[model samples]
Target: MQSPQYLRNGEAPQQQQQRLPPHFHSTVSVQKLRRFNTLILVFRFASFCFCLSSSIFMFTNSRGSHFPNWKDFQAFRYVLAANAIVTLYSFAQMGISVWEILTGSTVLPETLQVWFDFGHDQIFAYMLLSANAAGTTIAWTLNGQDTCTASNAFCIQSYLSIAFGFAGFLFLGFCCLLSGFRVVCFIIYGFRFLVL
Candidate 1:
């Protein structure tokens, strides 16, 4: 007995139906975001392990008078310490993100705060690593003169140490740059949230 609701142009009422409820879309978006965050955490953990292992190898195997002397060993030890510190810091960041995701509290505000924290942590870690590498290279090179003693063996080791140290420093620098970019993106998002 009752007529169907229609638009002023006579369209069917069903034509005005929304594709999805707001809650449904929000749930899906949150799930996807959580998955992404989890993946990043996994990658970061893996990287930490790799760096730690490499540092250990440099410290343990690359030693002795026939190879590197006590000074060289000391340099490698410093590098190992730096690597360990960075790994721990990264783990802490990952843990925080995981906690947020598990609690279903990973909103824009929380994520932005995490980003800011991570950026600062990353900057410090990277700078420390770079400084450690530079110091190690300088010590190894200067001490190589005494250890190598015209055999060229110490010179070769010194060059190898320099190469490895520089490579590590460059890699950390690249990571620092990437973190800076992430911080910028987070700032933009935070601004948008505040504006809206």
Candidate 2:
């Protein structure tokens, strides 16, 4: 019978192939991904609600009397347009979020979807923020003038619309951060960074 040969001096035995840890491809845990998906959905829905309400309030600010309406102010029109656009975007995102939640994958190709989410979220968030700022400035100026005194309802509606716009922007900003994180992880770890 022959015995197994031993390693010679200064010679090392071959090592077996080792399996990587579960988290080798992904830094975020499965639980974290689930939470993130849920958060994205919630934020998208919140944005939709706020932006929709903002648009409606701004659009309906007109009274039957001869008081100057939201359309009269360029800033107010911008606010309405921005919120309307954001509302549509948020509604679409909400559908995408629901799709991801039901299926652990994105509707579009993973890379394209991640980039799309990040880009759109950033653009719309900033758009809503700027619109709110301009609307707020106009509202403040109107408040200090006799216009607000004559039609306090218009001033109140304008402020309310702008408030909702800011709230929508805040939620959209959160979505942007989440999407940006996905983008960074993808850049570093590829699509394996998350199950999607």
**TM per prediction:** 0.53, 0.84
In model 1, which runs have C-alpha deviations exceeding 4 angstroms? 1-25, 62-74, 106-112, 128-186, 191-196
- The TM-score obtained by model 1 is 0.53
lDDT of 2 at 176: 92
Give the alpha carbon lDDT tens digit for every residue of 1-196 in model 2. 9754546553334321243544452435655676788999999999999999999999999986689799899999999999999999999999998888777678999889999999999999999999999999999899889999999998999999999999999999999988998899888777624552
Q: Candidate 2 has which clashing residue pairs, if any?
A: none
Q: What Cα-based lDDT does every candidate model obtain?
A: 0.55, 0.87
Q: lDDT, candidate 2, residue 167? A: 95
**Candidate 1 C-alpha RMSD relative to the actual structure:** 7.7
Query: Global lDDT for candidate 1?
Result: 0.55
